[model samples]
Target: MNERRRGPVLIELEDGPDTDARQGPAEAPREPGPSPADAPAIDDPDGPLPRPRTMEMVTRLIGRPPSRLTRIFINSGVALFAFLLSIAALDFLNGLLNSYPLLGWIGIALFAVFTLAALGMAWREYRAWARFARIDAIQRRAGSALAEGSLDQARQATRDLLAIYHKRPEMEWAAKRLAEHQAEAVDAQSLLTMAETELMAQLDQEARREIEAAARTVAAATALIPLALADVAAALAANLRMIRRMAEIYGGRAGAVGGWRLARTVMTHLVATGAVAAGDDLIHTVAGGGVLAKLSRRFGEGVVNGALTARVGIAAMEVCRPLPFIAQPRPKVGNLVTRGLRGLFD
Candidate 1:
């Protein structure tokens, strides 16, 4: 019988006495038995292979799954709406073009212009939206981080976010305004504190309080003068005989004379303050009556030239001089409303 040979067979022939002697069998011949790691077991029988979806399918899968024929419905709906809108727009355009067939040309020209305008506007809007989106996301994340008690993260987010806005001119301006307002408030508070401290240091507490109280009273009184003048003007507006005429209404001798006298008082205040007025400015005066008559004479003009002229100077004086002193302005709705409603009756 011919000897038979098996192809690469291995037998455990009891590890013949010298098995551990020379070295491991030629690089530890790859095991013929299944490996523990590679054993075909459990539910898996094959290796992984790629069957990636197409781009469009991937988009739908990651976002909204397509129902095979469903996209047609959406596209059809959009197309219908777009077609209707285009038809309406075409009709409107056709109407214009119908007037002058050349209007279609004009419209095309205008359309080009408007298209450019729309493009520019869209570009601007997209830029603004992009900026705002970045800002909003950063602020949102900053708020979340703050809430999570990671102050450093919140601050970093805030600074990074605001950095872009601070680069804008309008934002920079607004920030500057806010800083100025805060500085002014701080200065005002500091001055008030200093004033109080000074007063307390210079005078007994009661005396200081009294002085402050008296100062406030004087300010309050002064504040009433402008209002008083306004009331006087309001009182006269209805009764002035020449309410219509108004050319150089204050040129009347009486008004000029009156203005002179008032000017004198202003000069006196200047003098008291150790200042002086020019000779011409203090040249003349009204022989009789105070500011009321003079100013009354000023507005005292009604549809008449002399009356208007005579009263103009004093009236102007009364209105302008006292304004700086007044803090609270009186409401004028009553007289204004009455005048407005008069039209109804008319």
Candidate 2:
């Protein structure tokens, strides 16, 4: 039994230099991996990314003019629809009159009221277009005066400017100053410059305030509102209001239809001039790319929207202004954004 025992046997090996040499050299001790603390920090998961360019896209869509065929079709459709609607309404009214005299009278009265309202709206639109034309005339006169150095043209432009602002109480002081100093200006350039210094300065400040307010509104809406297309709508509405206010400040006094028209004009100019893209780069540079990198994506988008709004505001200023910037420098997007977005990110 002892000879045949199937018990487990154990073998022990001793460590030796010869044994170590036989085995391939032990892997060089791995250098300790850098501590987590030593590792470079990652950006915040919520940190800013590239702007969505929602506003810019919207601007382009609105700015692009319809083709002639499209315009014709739209016009024809609108006219046909209106005609059909009118015919239907009249047929309904006649039937009502035959069946229910009292109700028909009421309907007639309602129709009359609607007609008057339509007339009023048309009148207002007419006035708005006239105001825009007047602004254009003043700008042309100012340009001509400067180019030709014609004192008479300058004086005439000044007079038109005065006439435009005479009704506003805010302009009384500036108008007085302009009238007083304008006489001292011997040359066309000097007179217009003086007028700009006195009259335009106030308007410019007001316009800037409007732009800042609109920018703030757009930025806030873009950052906070998560709903799709909400930011675009807000941006469009804010821009429309801003453009309308600009027109009023510069004496365009645009009505609802006219305001939309003016906004289209501004967006068209911006798209054509490539200012929209340029403005984006300018804003990124001025705001410091790092600042946006520290912000959340939505917040970064908001900053960009606000900056583009400032650009639109500036363009609106150029369009609505009765005179081109001369005595005062055109407001820079960088400066405006810097001032406008103050405390927003902080």
Candidate 3:
């Protein structure tokens, strides 16, 4: 009776096919790959490096990799030159032999010896130039590695760089520190920081002294000299020297291109911040009637310019050094200017 009273073919709509049983759980949407903008850009190591126009031309003339036809031409030219040299040398030797019996043999031997020596010297010079190029290239690679945050590669490059300083007592400490850093397993930033702290201490100190001296000189020139142009010229000269020294310290002995780059960097810094000329009392100095006031004004201007020059030097360091100021904060332009102004008055 209860079975007969059961609900008439009641379909359980809520209890239909279990989605989990039929289709299983819906798979999560696939994740997208990184966008092009998000992808990191790596510098191509085999790409052409920056060089002065003169250097580029010279490199093309001598060190450039030749094509098949170019190589054939070069070989042919070298062969022709060698053939001409042999003909000239043989003729001279023959003349000597005809003129004097004993002297002729000696002359022939001497000529051969001199020719061999000359060739050896030329080869060595060529090798030296090539070595310098290779060293610069390695430095460029190290710089790139540092930029990419590749510490191991940068450290290895630093160590290899020490090879250039062999037998140089002045750079002995740097060599030692580089060796020490290489011996230890450390991150690139740490190694660079330590190198900057310890190995670069002397260089930094020397740079500071140079900055101070330049500042004083420029200030003296500006204050003591009557002509505004003279003061400006003096400032320019001091700034240039400071920049060049800084570049050299940072292992970027400036070729024309490098010098131009450094100059542009300094000029850009000037344009962007006006950090160098911020605190100068140029009008008061120029208009002031009294000798003391004028002297003080000139001194102040010099100090300001020198301070700016120092800033340029610091910027040069950043430009020339492969590693950036990642581990430590770079000095602020405002802070530097303030300190410079204070020092000038004091």
Candidate 4:
């Protein structure tokens, strides 16, 4: 039964030999694939996420319904289709057209117009979706690649960025800037690879120098450690409890000062001392820090020690004559306070 009611018409087909049944709700007419909004619900009884539907198909497949504008176009199309069918169904049109003047061709013309309009609307939907699907695919791949942190991500991001580039007419400005950024990022990665290779090929003289220097500084600190510890231990003696506590503290301090085993402990202590930067792990703590930063504190300190040592060495040579000066005793705050309080008397 067909009638022109200026509204949507729904056709129902029941489960028979022609239609598969025994399932969930009535399946919407199977489109090419599921749309994102209608993507299948997936969970891990064991593991593994559900697969994603392409974005374009996502809406159509899942009834991830398109916009009202889309509805407008689609409804328009359906309306046009029905309009044409109505004219064709009207058998009186042939005779009416034969009898009437301009009126004769009117039905035929409406039929042609509505037919073309329906086709155009359907085509627009498909075209918009195909474009969106391609772009969405590239984006999904790009996101996955980046998250994977593989070199492949570099390739995918670049491609996705390019795909996004061509997607819009107004995107030329964004595309140009992004292209420059991608180029720079790719170049930087390449340089890092090459530099790493060269550093390795040389057998890591730099690593050797830093590690060796740390080993030496630890040794030197250990050598002086006994004297420093003894001084602290002597003052805390008499009180056995205090003596034990002081010994443990200084012992840990001395051991960790340069001991390879306690490198982390010592560095932690030093930074906490607030003599240097306020931080826990310097690399993570420092905003906008770079590769050299990735090294642990112990290693960084080793390199820094080398630089400082060089500076000290240069200064040592220029220190031929200490600035001639008379030794001034350190101010005695206790004595000063006593004298001041003794009353200003002859």
Best by TM-score: 2
Pairs of residues clashing in candidate 2: none
Give the per-residue lDDT digits (tens) of candidate 2, residues 1-346. Answer: 4687699988645454356555665455468887999877685554444565767666876687789999899999999998998899889999999999999989989988998999999998998899899889999999999999999999999999999887789899889878777889889988988989988998999999899888888878878999878888888888889999999888877887788788899987786777877554475543563366365667777777777888899989998998899979888776776777774655
Error of 4 at 266 (Å): 54
TM-score order, best first, reads: 2, 3, 4, 1
Q: State the lDDT of candidate 3 residue by residue for 281-303, as single tens digits.
A: 32232222123333354444444
Which regions of candidate 2 deviate over 4 angstroms?
1-49, 279-290, 343-346
What are the lDDT figures for the candidates, one per model?
Answer: 0.35, 0.82, 0.56, 0.35
Candidate 1, run of 10 with poorest lDDT: 243-252
Please state the error at residue 52 of candidate 4 in Å.
Answer: 30
State every prediction's TM-score relative to the real structure. 0.23, 0.81, 0.47, 0.29
